[model samples]
Target: MEEQEIYLLITRYLQKETTTEENEILADWITDSVDNEQTFEEIKLTWQHTEQIKLEESTIALARLKNRINHQQDNKAKTKKLVPFKWNAVAASVAIIGLFLVGLFYLLKPNDSVPTTYSVLKTRAGEIKTITLIDGTKVSVGPKSVLRYPSVFNNSERNVSLDGEAYFEVSKNPHKPFKVNTGDLTVNVLGTHFNVNASRNQILTTVSLLEGKVEVNLNSDKDDAYVLKPGQELTFNRANQRVFQRNLDSLNTLGWMTRTLNLSNDKLSDAAVKIENMYGVKLIFADQPTADTRIYAQFNGDSIEDVLTIICASGNLEYKKQGNKIYLNAK
Candidate 1:
């Protein structure tokens, strides 16, 4: 299709007024070549970013085109005969829209030259992995977790999406703020050490700051933002869209980084959850009382059997281990 025809069809498509035939024509044109598809995407992106064209802007644009036409008239006397007056009017309209589109393209085009491409890193059950991001940030991913990030940091910001638990020691870069998006909540920081637990099985997503400051922005309500200092923690309950902050022990918050499990008078049921997550085991309680029993202990790099043995001995309970499952019962 001619450039003018393509722009017209693009305008119709943007306005959602394209006919079936026009749609097919545009689709075929876009599918014919990669360049065509990229052009179409650029046009679409520009159109979405630009505000609705105002009548005053269009009129001013047309007036500017008229002055250009008058200037061309001065040169017309020295050259061949100009196109017909009707053709000039039609050309003027197209020029106005074209100028508006060109201005929008330049005004709204992304400043960064880097193309955005994403890479996903995931860990299965009973697995833990560490990754160094392009920006030199170190991330320790816990079991059953996935992190999706851009292959390269953009000029504007560094962003990554996470699901499950991870410890991040972000490299210091104040100019490019780093952001972690966990669907329901977004954590923003410059250079900071933080632990985020956003496991799908958990009711609340927790963000614990180890060093530096970070801002937690709620997805449910964009206006809600909480700033967390070092040793402070923020919890976001997605169900009720409630967010609260509290002081947290830095050791407890950062323990998972070193495979250190600490339970300070934690309920048996809560500890069970932590054990299950840490060791990727299924803990079944024989009765509600056994599950509700409380215990206090700390385990550093302990095997699953040792941890369970300690828990059972402290609670006067018996635990039978089978493969990846453990059964806890009152002895």
Candidate 2:
């Protein structure tokens, strides 16, 4: 079993609720030899440290974070920024606090059991699932995406890993920050609405901020940070973790997690890929040259087959679905 699985089993054993097989495995594991006992001791020690961290400041920190935000709100109410782009310090601060809220719950456990977990939520091609995280962050995972998060976030930070794409509506807390770690770079936010695209095959990872604010920081040197405002998107090149900032259509970017695909002047190929992913099918473009043609339409509640049929007919393209694979050719 993986380290995380074994850790989970150990945690269950500590609760005295392990199953027969689990108990046997735990016994075999804990008493396999001197080394096994030593390892268990180490994990148990780590679990205890995690608990201590959680208890050390979860309540006080949460309250303080909330107060900071309220104080900021009071300031905003008194003096609204005349120029939106000049200084977004308040927005940045709030987003950070929002992230703090996500991190706070992770540190404290309602059940008081600090479980060791590295389990991930994943979907097949053409599948989508909405997840309510331990910290109450709402994540809409897209097709072929995976999310690896701790069973409970421990004190200090709220972090999760991404392998594909998802949209996050993070809960806010100022004392703790919410961070999403892709293989290449880390996306940190105070309490922001954002979309992350981190497919492994991608040459770069993308984060589009919808509302509030976010900070893009390199995992290597977190102190060096890049703050992002609403309507701004950050893309990090995988090879070097280079962060690039650009403008984006916030609504269009946030649409994915909501199962709403909005394409205005979208290329045929681009639209095809999204449809295929949403429905878990293949879309092969015949007459490859015609595939680059752009079409403008909003596909929120459309079936893949019907969407492809309509788009193809409009473009004078023909398509056939064989199992999950689709072959498209121009007439």
Candidate with best lDDT:
1
Superposition error at 197 for model 1 (Å): 0.9
lDDT of each: 0.75, 0.68
Summarize candidate 2's per-residue lDDT along 1-331 as a digit string, tens digits: 5444565566655455566556556645553444445456544434445444444454465565446446655576544321222123423444322322233444333555555667689998777888765444678898899999875565457889999999998866565589998876788876778899889976778889888998887767778888888889888887875778889876567665555677677788877766766777777776767788666666676777777777776677777888878887777
Query: How close is every model to the real structure, measured as TM-score?
Result: 0.64, 0.61
Off by over 4 Å in 2: 1-115, 219-224, 239-243
Q: In candidate 2, how many Å is residue 312 off?
A: 1.2
In candidate 2 the C-alpha lDDT for residue 155 amounts to 49
Clashes of 1: 0
What is the TM-score (0 to 1) of candidate 1? Answer: 0.64
Local lDDT at 290 for model 1: 89
Q: What lDDT tens digits, residue by residue, belong to model 1 across residues 213-259?
A: 99999887879789999889999887787778999887677666565
Q: Which ten residues in a row have the lowest lDDT in candidate 1?
A: 100-109
- Evaluated with TM-score, which candidate comes out highest? 1
